[model samples]
Target: MKKAGVTPHIVHVSTAYVAGARKGVVPERSLDHDARWRTELAAARAARESVEWDSRRPAVLRRLLAEARKDHGKSGPQSTSAAAEERRKEWVENQLIEYGRLRAQSVGWPDVYTFTKALGERVAEETLIGVMPLSVVRPAIVESSLKHPYPGWIDGFKMADPLILAYGRGILPEFPGLPDGALDIIPVDIVVNATLAVAAAPPPVDEPAYYHVGSGARNPLTFRGIHESVREYFTEHPMPDGGRGQIKVPEWTFPGARRVERQLRTGEKVLSVAQKLLLSAPATKRTRHWQDDLTRQQDKVDFLRKYADLYGVYTEAEVVYTDNKLLALHRSLPADRVEDHGFDAAVVDWHHYLQEVHYPAVTATMRKATVGRRTSNSALPPLKRSANGGDVVAVFDLEGTIVASNVIETYLLARLCDLPRSGWPGELADLVRKLPRYLAAERRDRGEFLRTFMRRYAGADEAGLARIVHDRLGDALLRRSHPEAIRQVRKHRAAGHRTVLITGTVDVLVQPIAGLFDEVVASRLHVRDGRYSGFLESPPLVGEARAAWLRRYAENAGALLTESYAYGDSYSDRPLLEAVGHPIAVNPDPHLYRHARSRRWPVAQWKAYTLPVGDAFLETVP
Candidate 1:
């Protein structure tokens, strides 16, 4: 395009971190720097250990222990043992930090936002330079703009807004990081102006031109300054109805192991008491309060886990040092262009921008995006009853209704009995045949049933079991799902009729299929150490349990239970079908057909798949 006489101004917006080389500072960029990444790695390692920790069996555990002992012995004792240990610990900590930083760099900045920008810079350097007019503008912490087209024009919450919201709501109790640490905040207008200036200026031919636009270097504002400003602003404005009126300025606190231990212990004790009260008490105001308190405490715990180690630590101090370079480039441009596009930061007032404008803009924008739209048709078709006063609640059975297979028992047998595809069909036949007996015995003695089952066949590793489920069982189940059945359910939901898929399948299998239904009533299985304990710790779906779940779903949906529709192909779903007003049999088995016919319920059969409302529903809803 450029060779064809098109002058393309490729505006590459990159992070100021890439310009860190000029300031001699390392930027922590990458997904590896993410707190969740570390947490997940630790969890995976812990899980591996937990699954094979017992050494009495000796095969896997002995190999792991021997490897650990070998590694532990590599570091021999030294002179000044305590000092050496301390030094070693520090070295390990530094290595981990560097590892995280490198990981982040590999992924780009600490998150996707900066990494994409860095990629854009590289693209401009490699392809755009000399080919087309190109200028790379680096913005450090591009925050909410104070004055763009107007005052308080913010795109979205970038960096400081989340922390500010947390602080204002008293959700953040302690301040993390060094009080004196540099907080490089740049208003959006300044960033925009720099972008415009770089774009309008003549490109430096034969070389790539760069501009570092930020605040900390030209006009430094410390973390302390930010905290103070936030406190002052919130105090004056007094968050809606004096809701964070008593805003307190945070003091820098250093990381101490003993202090952390004490805090955790205190928090645990309070949380434990709150949890007990919430579990034991019936639904009431006090119970609700306790639950909220427990949730808030957990949030605090999560927050601490992310920031505790780095709290009050002045980690980085580099500022934008490309000012002279940018200024020189600006001067080289023609006078008219320079006058028209000036990348000046001193003209902007950060405090006024953040407090007076940015906050309000963010709140308004979020409100518009999040608040649900109101429809013109207030008189919606009754979800519980059709126009002819027929039942509308459409309940689907798990195994044969929507899904093609009995996922729960199939998954359990595969995991516990090591039943592969070649052998599972026979095993399934046997299990189904013996299910009545096992269920009867389960009611009498669960421990006996589990022991008998495990003793009979429990030898497969976690990987092998997961492979069998995902590759074999899952594939078969997904393939077997009657396309017409799914289409009908989707149709009912689109027609303003409440649709629910009730199953005796475990959460792992059922949750994946949740996208197919409006509400899922799946069995919850207790999993420990990456494997099922081969027991249903909770009551299975039957009788009152099934009816209660349906009734609650109906109540919450504001639909009449007696005027709702239900569809099933099994005798086991009799209670559920009876609970609803309308019962329909879809591809019903002999027993279900007989039962439905006796009850005078409607029977619908479909040869082709078609969503009830069709193209019109998709166009109107989504």
Candidate 2:
């Protein structure tokens, strides 16, 4: 209104949560009554440009990526078109969320959403207060309508709605919440009515007018009460899940975040073991097909836990929203008009609303969606290599391709030596001893480093080294497989293409990942008379050498080179990638990232790392 040079009345709809990370009585007014946003806003803007902003992002992205890698087992549309779009949307949302989370952490907000909403209020107050009539209506958590166009009307799950739905379906095993804490949920119609009332009636220009359209002050609903109501309702009516009986009501747990994290990690390990065992089982021997179901349920559990972490603050808060302005406004409304506009919270029956309206509506909406659908386990098992042709194959680089870590370095430092490579005088001595060779290798070729590192394993018994790798480095190597890389590898296998692992790392080091592939191409350390030869049996299988190996293998197997796929992580793998019809740059180093962009090749960042792509890196993308 001020921008248009007119003093129009404005009703800015905001959230009562903007009161932020606090407890006790929260009045319908700004927290910073001294108006510190005038300076704080400037500081926030500057922080975005400051070095600290750039410095903090790697850690934030790492955390987000850690969570994103987990599967929530929700089955999305199987159609190719929808699947691609869904993946894109998920990626974009995750990126934006990570950016906002980092900003929130730096600026000291509970979360990005609330922090941004608070900033919006400041914008209105700083820019429009004196020039225009502004009425800020801060509504607490809004749910389906109590009474409006329809009693159970809700467009989609919002705020606490998902938890309510999950509870009804018996999926929410436990929720983190304070039993006595006020939930402060309000109906959509009441908020809308209050907003209209404020907009229509100007409450004296330039006066501080804030209305709390919430239920805590009048008809309160605690988190415990909400859960109880949902349980009771589902027990009575049950979820309309096409005859699939609802699971029992979940037990609520109020353990702290740290406890929850520990439990989740433990659960993940157990589920992972189950999944691996299921996958390893022979196709015809297993009595039941538990792989898909187990995978799906595991994903759902992870998703629920993540949601709990995101909204845990609200569930545990003890804030009571003061709605004096809202009550006074309702009283001033014409008696006849009150019936038309449902602004009263006292009339809302929580039990009836939950059972007769909310649960049914949410279930109906969910049923329309294709997500979380269970499929029959009637399909034949995965194809064996002997049953497949050699027409197509996928060549993958091991170190940065299959896993994010360099196995050679890890093996040398952690498994080979007696002294702890990561601590004390051992680390210092190793660094000092290897400093000259490392410098020499840098001045020479990339393979020089590999050769120098391999000398550390000289005269080591091959059998003893294999045992050491299995005992120490095996699990760590398997754990670092990039989700995207794994998906791509599976995609190729599903298409009946042979999978190959090619790397410069010696066979002993790459043993953990070897079984996943049909053939492994790697440098082999030569031994004579069961003693040190300290020389490669063959040239290091990297760069042009890797490409040559692929060509020779393709020719021998009669594989269609142009129909094959390859994934690599560095510029050195350019020859291997260029040799294939389909090439992907996975977790690329700086040089390869630019080259991939220039060539319009698809790029994927499977792991978070601090690789600078020049000063414009952060600016050039969201």
Candidate 3:
């Protein structure tokens, strides 16, 4: 800035956490002693390039392929590439978050934000401290306005707000902290006042000032104080629970961060074991129900773990910053201006600010935005005039849709039942070794999963496998299939609608069932010299490939797509289901259930053996 006639000054706003892990009265001053600014800045700048380089490695791409297949497998080749990029971005972001936090912690700071704040101060001092007047105003956990503009005004949730809401809504049953530790919360208005004062009258050019705008030293509010205030506010005003009146708030126990993390880990381990055991189970209604329950449990565990890891450090910290320069600036002001424009922490009331201002701002605003709305799981009305069956077609997904068995279970049933009891353990062990890759393939590309899984039959005669498919496997499948789903297919066939069974399952397994349908589209295994080649003849009939195939088939058959019906169960079947007029979700997994809900499509649970009258629609409300 040009400073020929006017007194020029730079009032830089920084955070009080520059004090880092130092346990003492943190005075208002520069905390830059170690030379880390250059290294941290360089590392931050080159982080993405470093991550991109690593992400391209064969192993990393293999892992990213699964995620890409999940979200973009059916989207197209372009979407698949975009998915890979999106996953790469997420990988880089996660790496940066962990790297920053660990690096900051290594140097005694709590998190990356504070460590970088200190770096900013270093840059400012090196660039302008000696050349011009500079005053750095460091605020501690700046929250809603205390008394500026309005009492309870904030743009969004700040540092402490998530924790507060979590506690109020009873999502977090325990508080992780030092019960007596001072929480250095400062109102935005006070920070603003102190910043303006420093800017209006610049500090002396010779001595650069660091003003701490916080309430930790003077009005030190402890964990107990905060808990009581929050409790009082929430006890008076509990949140709504749909039609269940009010949600109950759990009384918090002061379990330190370490113990809480341990508890969460235990829960995670237990859930993991259950999930593994259920992995090989048939996709029965009971199994899917248990899986859904475990999914919700895992989600909650993840949510709590995230909050505990991110906010745990600050909540447990006992750092207290002293606002000496800020108080001195307030003292320098005339007595008449102090009331209207003062940076006074001691005069602020903790309970009043939290209960009347901050908490109200959070609860009232949040409730107003979400109270009147809920996701409708009901399906849309049927078409007014039914089209002729000759003009319409019906499409169905094989696994987790018409049948209660996935690729793994069906293949295992055929293979294990065909082999002697003695060879069962060896076959199972080999499958266990390749389970992760197979699972990834199943989510990403059904055809890939089918091809890879069928490689186990390489040495066996094609006649024997076909025998298993036509006889024992067919009987097992009949017992395992969804009756309601089969009934729907028969209904369409009887009405003269062309029924098509499209699946990534090989032709052998679907051949016995082909008699029930007018047309059957399935994956084909390449056979060389009457031995299985463990490869596919064509691209899998899945993802966007399925949509393209369906379009071609409909055009040749003169099937009216808008008058047709389609049923699917997994996210990979989304393209097929979405191509038709009537899309139904049958025994849908988590992703498909959410998609079906968002689209308000019919969702079925096909209880396999016996589906009750009123239990047609699945309740995926977790």
Candidate 4:
């Protein structure tokens, strides 16, 4: 520090990647890439505020929320507001990384890591050129060890380790790299020795020393060479995949980055289409497994995309670093210490190191954490009477559980299915316009959406609406009902355990299935003189209110809340599910599924059914 007064000799350990995007020979010295460090700093400092402003935009917020909860099988948000905040942070962080890369490349660098490090060097030199005696040690890719700290001791994956692991695990089928390009790998021990030598023998203050501690100059390793070594290692000692036999390693064609990325994009597009079709189809055991596999395939593609972006610059770059200074430093060591503490990389064997030490350490840490804790989809939780036998109840959420149809669909079926197809367009258009408001309210509290949307029924004849539900909506509800879910409801009833339906849909829509459960709890619309008042007579039974209502019901009925069972399909039903002894996710929405998986709770998909043409009414509802 400048303020320390006794300004200590400084040894800045920078990466050889500082030679970013530069080709041919790289000398251990300052580069002249015309980057405006001060300007870049100002722009980077203002990014968070800019991102905060962007997060508040309605469209961005909505998209991020959807991504956090429901875009493919990504782990859903833990809580709604918390999920929004978490997604906002992730979005902001990603934007910053992207922006950093753009600015870095604008000044002729590869990525954010190299760009910032270069800028930092410039800032340090400008501030402390004459104030401190400085020496810079630039290491290339630091791998496990050559002969220090015992041969194969490594904790986590380095930059190149992921590619190796992915290849071994059969996740990365192919990779792009220049076969003859210099991959300037240096053993961790060599880098350490080189740094210590520079620190011990500090350069003169005015003439700061620079050392390239890498293998590129003395003994260069090619991308093709490393690939062969990896292939051989994996082929001889194959990696196991669960209980399945050892995975086969695919051969690399050394395809260019453009080709690899193009193939990945095509694969991604196909998977996206498949996912959309699967979501639309009925939820069956086979379909659910296919969806899971799709999610994993998409993840593999994402992993390849990520590593290619992060590590490609190193592997594909043609530059060979000249490390004459480090070699000279190594030679100057005492005769006895030269063999032990030598910083030279020329004597090291890449084949022996990777095959014997590094690969084994990396693979040992890749075991799945969720392996023993998984509950099979086909296995149901044991059904038993509570200590207080009669108190045991099964609670099922209405939408996507007992019935795939939601509030909007049930209401629309009663309100508009009888109307001419020409009139349907106008009604749907009106619904579309108000959909955002309803969704926002629903996100805040399920009861709010029900309360606000139910206002549409005001002044309608209550008896007439009942007639509409009885004549049309009942059949629609049954048509969309999940067969296994209905079976569970009846199973609970037969066992003498109270079965309850807790929903945000109005009681009128629920009346059709009233006989299925012993108790029906739904939003009750107020009626004045046989005409609808368009307001809730009581607080809607959803979310935490529903949980509290169940508690009271259990207490009054001499039942135990802990002895009951709850099945839900929405994140809003989390509170209700948490109130029971057994909580099952029945074709759960993303957020609920994520929660359920984390807790190792039982998850099941109730087989969904297709209804007539107009029955896909709730598809666009939030």
Candidate 5:
């Protein structure tokens, strides 16, 4: 438009990655052509190699190294030891070459996504934007809009998707950034609007105009805020089917280098002793050499702090520069358009966008795209209770509460008994009888138990067992559900309460049951190729996890924590029960029952096996 007899003004949408690399107070037109970035990238590569090669290194050590490399060249020791530092640089170069080859073979792009973008920015600066009346708009991570147009219309995979997916999957259990780190995010609509306005506005003749359209300047939403908003939204809407629900955003700190340094120092001391002992043994000498190599690799990992500090400084600086540029541009824009077009950052309602628009859109999309599923009739009994005057939250315990038997022990026994079909129950009984002896002798020897059980019962196919659970045992399982428990839940809902069921059962087993309640919160099982990996797919809903889920739920529902009620039968539910105002113990195990009584919490007993309501109730609740 600008070139077609128009002003030919260009608005270059840049990334916060470049802007974040700045140090201290940066000038308005500062570009990312500094030497420090290359050094930091090299350090990061070195760190990645160390993590991949060092088998003996702790996970935390690998993470710290990775983080250090990402934030390289900011504020930390550049070199702890000269030899170690040299090794890191060499390794980084080798890795970069390897990455280049891989990129050529695969996507014809660089191995690192961030590096590719940085290169693109460099090219843009040198060729296109440099000569034109252009404005570079650097957005940190484009997330769901806070307001304007619509909320939660995210079009790209950046921090929001990865963060949410990781948290939901429990891959990221903690935040790994500085407390003050600006989480640069822009809504898609806001970005579009800003880009349009910038294009329409006249650009400065001296330099290519740059606008950092993100939360860092105009809206200034922190990492904490993003985390909290997500938590709150998920809590209220929840995953309709199953899997782990609301997760707490872990704490963050700036002194990640110090934390890593302390760990490395302690680890090196231990490895040194082990290395000496291995070298002394004649048969272990080869292993000792390998260990030495691994140690050297770890040392390289430790040396990554220099790069991390450097990058951190650059990133911080760029953010400052981008913020200043964005502010200046906002100031220069027409007052009417800034107001009418909703381009004024000061007037932007972040809370409204986040809570009202973005969250609802995200929730709806998740429900339709991912969690939508038809509930099986055998999965859960119909809801007998209607919500009444107040909102209600239902909490269900897994194991004996949902399924007729404990899943782990049953699977173990199924393998050991070699019990096929009719014989499975008998074999299970036999295993239970001998469980005490096995426990005394093996003491939680899971590997041995699984191997032995599999050897015995390997002939029975998984399909057959699933079919039995869905058909024969399913009805029995529902019948076994406590009537008193159902009644209590219904009573609360009849009083206009929002009911939720929280459990530690895997989604395959839990999703069907989720249809029984307004929402279901359960433990997640990792599945690959439609089969259970016998591992938790995400963090279990226990202790602090339960409380966190409750908090998210309250935030989403816009309800008071004090007005909520929680019910469970296990000792693990203590944290959850205490989190809400009303705590109810349902068919509590002896220990939990006693504890609940001691705390003056109400206790209710349910008849061990039977759905109190019919299918009609289920239809009514929905």
Candidate 6:
């Protein structure tokens, strides 16, 4: 309205959650919690310069770090300086997010989303008071339509849908929420009707009208009621279990936050110990399968913990909205109009809505959503390898060791999809910020960074990705290929050794260069209906996983481990290098250089655009 410079009546669509963290009867009025939010907003704005604009927040931070490093001198040993810079940047970004979260939670709102909404109301109230007639309608959680054009009209998963979906799937065994607390839900149609009614009759000139369009005051439905109705609905219309018969309706145990936190900590420790034990043991197919399962379970635990941490407060709070203005407006409306609009919340039957309409609609939507998605290793067919009866093998890490640059990262940050080149600066800043995460992956779980990074290709088609590699990344990668590395692989081929190009990059991208090696052991991305499922068919073959695969291949093909040769260019490749008798770090990063020196290993720098190593060097083994 301010930007438009208009005196037209405005009906501002806002959340009833402007009540903030205050309990008891929440009157339909403006938010009064400004003391905390003001300080928070100021602090947030002050640190805004630290953040670079990009699609993903994490990626943006990474790019900023990279930029900082580039701005600083890059010569001699930069490991210490680079590490410090990365840590500082990571710490700043983390602190900014943490501070914002804390500031939001401190003022009774569960998250910044709701808290910011309340602040927006303040801005409108202050700025648009004299210019236009304003009526702010604060509606509670808007769910699917109860009765309107359709019985259970829904577009996508809304606020509480994920929790409800999890419950239906028998995954959410427990939730940290108050069963007795009013959920304060309102239908979408009612909110629209209420907005229209308020817009038709705005408050007196210079006086803003506030209405809470929710069911909590007159016809409250508690979380316990919602849960029971959903459970009954699912029990009657049990989802097919494929092979496990009927999936039992998950019995939720509403534990306190403290209890849940304790359980989470304990469970994490147990999972960690088990994972370590599994890692220490032999990397057979059975053991690897178990490890993968544990990783999935760990992912679930992490998600649950985060969900509880963010939303648990909402369940605990018992703030019932008093929609007196909303009721008055409904009463003032024409009898015919009221009948047509049906803006009244008191008439809504919670039992019928949850059991008959909402739950069924949500489940149906979920079914459709799950159709073309893969959640298992069966998604991608295995890559058939020609049987090679050999006693010698050569393992090469494809990215830095062979190609000189990370082709997969380049594909993601540059040419994966046809995006605007104007956004490259922001993206580069994001990559710089994420360098710490990459370093962390190298330091600990090597595949962690790849797993998180590859999620960008979630909905891309398999064939399309191949075309991308062949057309865009292929020529660039081949050009950047280390001549020395190519010669080394050929020498291994001459010796009758099975040359394997192993990488965490998708096998499809690396398939163009497949003819250069006897076997390609790169990570295979799972596909469903020819589209990427955003999951690996197997654990990414990097770090320890790479070493394990090498051992397995050696044993299966009768290759001598003591006679095998491996070449890599990263700290993440340390395990692979250590597995072979001849371990060489080619164009090694600072971390890998230090590690190789400590181990008395040979480190070679391969110039991408320079001449290849002489024939004499290739003829003899170093």
Question: Highest lDDT among the candidates is held by which one?
Answer: 4
Question: What's model 6's overall lDDT?
Answer: 0.71
lDDT of 5 by residue, 1-622 (tens): 6556655665666665553333444444646444244555576577676745652245634554554433221111231122234545565566655655454224322224444555556566566544567676766567676545544666655445544543332333233345455555567766777777678774664477766666655466665666667666555545544333333443333345456456556765776676555433432324534543555445444433333332333223234434565566667766776654544455556667666765566555555655434321112223323233334455556554444344454344224323345665676688788677554432223223333333333344445445544644445445545665566556656656677877654444454355667778765544455554555545555544667878887777776667677767655466677777777766555445545645667665445553333331232222
Candidate 1 global CA lDDT score: 0.55
Q: Please, what is the TM-score per model?
A: 0.47, 0.53, 0.70, 0.71, 0.38, 0.58
lDDT of 4 at 58: 98
Candidate rank order under TM-score: 4, 3, 6, 2, 1, 5
Q: For model 2, how does the per-residue alpha-carbon lDDT over 1-622 read when each residue is reduced to its tens digit?
A: 5587766887787888887677689887765733355576676566545533443466654543333322111111122223344544565556556666766656546687777778788888777777767888899888888778888787778888777777766666767778888888888888889899888787656775898888888899998898788777777766654345445676676675567667777877888788656544532213133543565568567777778768887888888888887888888898889987848787788888777877777777665552444333222223234244878878998777777667344554333333332453565577678779775663344576778877766776777667656765565555656766677677677778899998878777777767778898888889877644668887687566677889999999988778787888776687778888767777665445545655656665565233332211222212
Q: Give all candidates' CA lDDT scores.
A: 0.55, 0.69, 0.77, 0.77, 0.52, 0.71
Clashes of 2: 3
Q: After superposition, how far is residue 85 of candidate 6 from its true place, in Å?
A: 9.7
List of clashing residue pairs for candidate 2 = 72-299, 72-300, 73-299
Q: For model 2, give the 10-residue run with minimal summed lDDT.
A: 70-79
Candidate 3: segments with Cα more than 4 A from true spot: 1-4, 45-51, 58-91, 277-280, 284-292, 369-540, 548-567, 574-584, 589-603, 606-622
lDDT of 3: 0.77
How many residue-pair clashes does candidate 1 contain? 7
Pull out the clashing pairs in model 1.
29-104, 29-105, 29-109, 30-104, 30-109, 177-312, 393-565
Candidate 5 lands at a TM-score of 0.38
Better candidate number, 3 or 5, judged by TM-score: 3
For model 3 the local lDDT of residue 496 reads: 76
TM-score winner among the candidates? 4
Regarding TM-score, does 1 or 5 come out ahead?
Answer: 1
lDDT, candidate 1, 540-611, per-residue tens? 554335667878766766667766777776544566677877667665554444455556576554332232
Candidate 2 global lDDT: 0.69
Residue lDDT tens for model 6, 1-622: 5577756887888888877777799888777765544665777887665442331366655665565443222211243245445766676677667767777778667677788888888878877887788889898989899777688886777777777777776666677778899988888888888888888886765899999999989998887888888788878877645434555777666777688778888888998788667745643446645755676577667767767776677767688899888898899987878776858999898888888888888888666655544443221111222235477678888887887567345555224244455765675677678778765654444566678767656788788667666656565556667787787777778767788888887787776578989889877878899988888888777656677888988988888877777888776676678788778877666545545655657666666754232321122112
- For residues 7-106, write the lDDT of model 3, one tens digit per residue: 5798778888777877768888878468578887888778757876887788988889777865667546655877787887788788878877888888
Please give the TM-score that candidate 1 achieves against the real structure: 0.47
